[model samples]
Target: MPHTENHATHREVELLETLRAQGGSARTSHLADVLSVSEETIRRTVKVLAKTGMVQRVHGGVYLSNTEALDPVGSRLKIRTKAKGQIAAVAASMIPSGSCVFLDVGSTTAHVATGLRSHRDLKVVTNGIHAAQALVDNNDNQVFLAGGALYHVEDGTFGPETIEFVERFNIDVAVISIDGFDCETGFLLSSAAEAALARAVTQRARRVLVVTDVTKFGQSAPLIACKPRDVTAVLIDKLPDRIFHQKLIEWEIEVVVVPDSKTGKTR
Candidate 1:
């Protein structure tokens, strides 16, 4: 089966959500009951989710991967650091010093915020507390943080208030992050709140730039961030396969592959 088409099925999401509600781990039989499915069915879904690094299967049960836990900010920051930094460098270069920018709570977007630390006089809007902290105080920049419920899992804020605050800005560029992207889904996020904010900014911003590493290329997430038509560019650490590359062309999305610093050549 094609990965994109089969990614994050409704059953899989239900299973994961149930596991989370059960405190991030559960017995296989219990999961089968909660999802109202057979034990074999639960095993099959767990196997698939495990392959995607979303879960871990043990003797007779499964648990959410540390990277998939409710509070995953630290674990996420430790993953693909080099690739994320390279992509962030490319994304930061695209923004001028005095432009209005929208950033998000994803780990990759946190790296992008770091890259922008040196840029002065930026008008920034973001839900990531870390993102806002990174860009403030170094320069005469203005940062508006979305207030409401704090999403401790990703260490960000989101709610109707977050969405309304984001809609208030006419952003020059919205630099967001994603959990997955493919020809079929365009861009995907694991958090519904983050996805809502992404959608709001993509509509209001003049440009929407997605900052993610190559690992997300073939994966899937529960929420759709935006379609390819809404994105202005994608900054990544490496090139995607030929099929996905062609899809980017078809969608008229700009692909910015950050060069490998070791060789100083585009990967």
Candidate 2:
């Protein structure tokens, strides 16, 4: 469950769209006012985009880069941090006390790991180096990092040995995060190894929960992890438009649209 820039924030996405619309360049002040954030924050976000080759930062603002889309985890952590936090709180509620949970790698799942910081009597196993590290300190919660090949950029472990190692545990709930999921195609992801890891863990869990946000809807990826019908539940932020994805519920997959904790708004 390695994270990707696929979870980019609404502001970042809007900025990119605005840049594209403005013939590949825009003023930083204009963007800050449009996004209602400080100029410093906008500049910081631009610097990250510039470093990632997604944009070229000019004196006043940025221009779109010709480089291909790079969905790195770090960029994603900055994007949608709040929405993912809200989603995490809801997903964390599903795990009962003393449950054996399989936490996967992904920015959203990382939030879930953070949301669980106060919980006690939980056993956690994960392929994510970050997720494993986030859960290791609790006196009541035990953490295990499945051993295998380390994918540095994705911050995940994978391979046959890793899959075999994870299969040995009887997990109460498999908490997974994915990219590019659709009601028809189910779970699709950018990395084959991460998708393989997801499939392997879900195969052994008593229940499977796909924790994701609306950004994933209708996107495409090379690998299909699982179908909606196969998952036990899907925890998502309430998207403004869900009429087209109603079939997902018809598939018998429970859908939980989490509300923003601060605003108390589902949309």
Candidate 3:
């Protein structure tokens, strides 16, 4: 049977997810058995994935190449879908139409772009391809994509040129996403290049909004994206712990918790 582009892509994503679950490397035979496909099929899927620099082939298995950076946006969109949707909705509510917004390359930010579709006019600046694609063709919105080296793994532009491109815009609100958070660190991201870009956007924007899920709490990342004082507000799916909550109060950062959709109450 011939594999259509969509079907092959779906199989590739499933294999990658399985690899992540198995600690970023898996035997070809094991992957074949788990995915209920032939070893030849697994090899073919991995061949396509490897060409994109997403995976590396070994003697009898494959390993993910970029473990340091955040997962690809496609894989991340599948994670915490409900939580991200709620956060995106709350984030959209904060920004009025015709606002100049800066959205970063985070998966949650992509969802926020979707939420902004109903607005009449929006000036959207972003490095994330996903966010730009979502908001490009709706309600007279203008999307400015930062130009620089494109990182295919994260599906966003980065480097010094990207930063310079964003600096040209006067951002009304900057919506960011974090990989981890803590009282001391404030917000965290896995990539240093991305962290620098986030810092630049935060400095340029009048209001800085960090959108993330509660799972990031207590986790740690190498680079601190921004301090708590730099943030205007945070939109999350659930409440943070006591100590973290207290710190947000001290920093005067507004905390907006999206209620659980099923229960209509914040957790």
Write the residue-wise lDDT of candidate 3 on 16-114 in tens digits.
767866768999999999999999999999998787556799999998775644467888888888999989998999999999999998889999999
The alpha-carbon deviation from the true structure for residue 121 of candidate 1, after best TM-score superposition, in angstroms, is: 1.6
TM-score of each: 0.82, 0.71, 0.75
lDDT per residue as tens, model 2, 139-223: 5899988889986656778889889889988899988887566554567665567777887777778899888877666654445
Please report how far candidate 3 places residue 254 from its true position, in Å. Answer: 0.9
What TM-score would you give candidate 3 relative to the actual structure? 0.75
- Stretches off by above 4 angstroms in model 3 are 1-69
Off by over 4 Å in 2: 1-70
lDDT of each: 0.82, 0.74, 0.83
The candidate with the higher TM-score, 2 or 3, is 3
lDDT leader: 3
Looking at model 1, which ten-residue stretch has the lowest summed lDDT?
1-10
Instruction: For candidate 2, report its TM-score.
Output: 0.71
| Model 2 lDDT at residue 4 | 39
